[model samples]
Target: MSELHDEVLRLSGVGKTYNPGTPLAQNVLQDIDLRLARGELCALIGPSGSGKSTLLNLIGLLDSPSAGELYLQGRPTRALDDAARTRLRNRAIGFVFQFHHLIPAFSVLDNVLMPLMIRHGKPDAEDRARALELLAAVGLADFAAKKANQISGGQQQRVAIARALVTRPALLLADEPTGNLDTRTAESVFALFRRFNREFGCAVLVVTHDPRLAAQCARTVELVDGRIVRDAANTAAK
Candidate 1:
């Protein structure tokens, strides 16, 4: 609760179950309560089947919870309609996945502008400037004109980070964003998340398996069998 004054995302008793009937039902998450405040950088860590991604999806508003409620910026989101949810999601949440899903045909700058274009009809000068600025912030200013496929894997991931932050979202959710990168590159990528969280005051909840990576975060939340087993401050490993 470093920035307790303003909570960006809150989950209360949230749970999710897939195919709730016909003998194929499975509870992926259980009663869970978590909160992310502005400017907080938290790591979510657990084993492979611990439901970390499912929890992230619930917080991102990409998937609905089967029980409890999620509040985004203090507004109840569980009851919001599809249109309302989409609007809120676009305005409030940014997502980064393990794979940098940049379009091979689009330039780095254009790919960053894609989010804005989706929300509006076309990109104007201001939007383009913002996208470029984000690229620069991610240390990719010179690569703005390069096609995504032409960049290195680490550079491509940086471009992905820039794309996620182009909209200046209040909450950023990354699911194993560094899982596919080398150890050194993964550390650097994780540092970028820290920089954004501190510089932009955007709350970041990143799912990672590396203990070294998790140790860099201010806070860590561990999930086990869809339940939050530990949520606490990160201290030097003994």
Candidate 2:
């Protein structure tokens, strides 16, 4: 494992409260402090209602923290405006959700190129080449011409991983990315995450419930009742 000093994502005393100032107000996370270093593969695991997703959202820059500060690439993000946050997120973060969220109408290649297209108008040959390279990396080069919906669940998730990598993000966040797959398939997908983290030197934070899956990561952070309970090295079981 790398030193914590080389952190990519850092959360200090972070907290989140929803619907503040109303009867529905509820605190979802409390005093969360964590750090993810480049090339690190960490697992965020907790039971239902443990605020794992909330914490992930906060770190991914998709939601703001109610307290404390979050640093991405060593820059404090508490004061960044929406446009600044969006630009920072686009340049530094990649996300994969439980659902692949690929457009069924678009071809797999186009789906992988979505991020690049959003940043710049049309995809040039270089962009297309990178998209194809990612597809090949995910073992889906042949599926590039097919519509997203034509692929299997596992294949679609692979495409999502490729799409996430298209941006060459420094931090990759995945929430239950393998939740819908069979055990074997899930292992395969998880392996791909490990491969990419090593090859691209990106920090990965994945939320999962399976102990076996969590065990595969280099570090694991456990949350319960909106608070961090444990953070430790995996120490792979013999």
Candidate 3:
């Protein structure tokens, strides 16, 4: 089967530790087994210090697990070298954080095209067209020429989401993406995630503190003290 149709991510007994092999070592996650399928939209919810961030880091390939294995598209990542990991991350993942890290001086269009430019210098015509399409999808079609700072906070965040999708990554990770927006704006932003997930078949795993947001996802995974306490599905039905 093609990778596009396979599980986007899998964690088996994944665990994290700080100051390993020492008395001060702290275990944040342990025996975490989870899988996210293609086109699935799930919410990751946990309290402060529950290791949500740590778990995300491991999934995103930004950090390594202290134990267990993390697989992306069926590729084991524990032994991958830095260059290999970076390449995989660039090719397979898109990230949106709570803060819209748009470049203030760059035009919104340029900001949205930033990822492709980083991977391959200069944007081709097709790349520009793709960015425009995303901007329009995010309701920022006309703001492309303006600087990122000139737009409303919600608008800027929309641009960030567009930027994240420009690469058409197989998996999209959002960490508290709506935490800074007003309720209305937050809903709009989340709606974009749902829209893109349906349109592109990219799996979405978002970490949010808002119960309202968590409940909206098809599946909700609750983490407590670095372990998955509950992994519930069919949320919309319940």
lDDT of each: 0.90, 0.93, 0.92
> Model 2 clash pairs?
none
* Model 3, residue 98: C-alpha shift (Å): 0.3
TM-score to true structure, per model: 0.96, 0.96, 0.96
Candidate 1 segments whose C-alpha is farther than 4 A from its true place = 2-5, 236-238
Cα miss at 7, model 2 (Å)?
1.6
lDDT of 2 at 92: 93
Model 2 C-alpha lDDT per residue in residues 84-191, reported as the tens digit of each score: 999999999999988999999999999999999988879999999999999999999999999999999999999999999999999999999999999999999999
- For model 2, state the Cα shift of residue 141 in Å: 0.7
In terms of TM-score, how similar is model 1 to the real structure? 0.96
lDDT tens digits by residue: candidate 3, 66-132 = 9999999989998999999998998899999999998999999999999999889999999999999
Per-residue CA lDDT of candidate 1, range 109-185, in tens? 99999889888869999999999898888889999999999999999899889888988999999988999999999
**lDDT at position 163, candidate 1:** 84
At residue 129, give the lDDT of candidate 1: 93
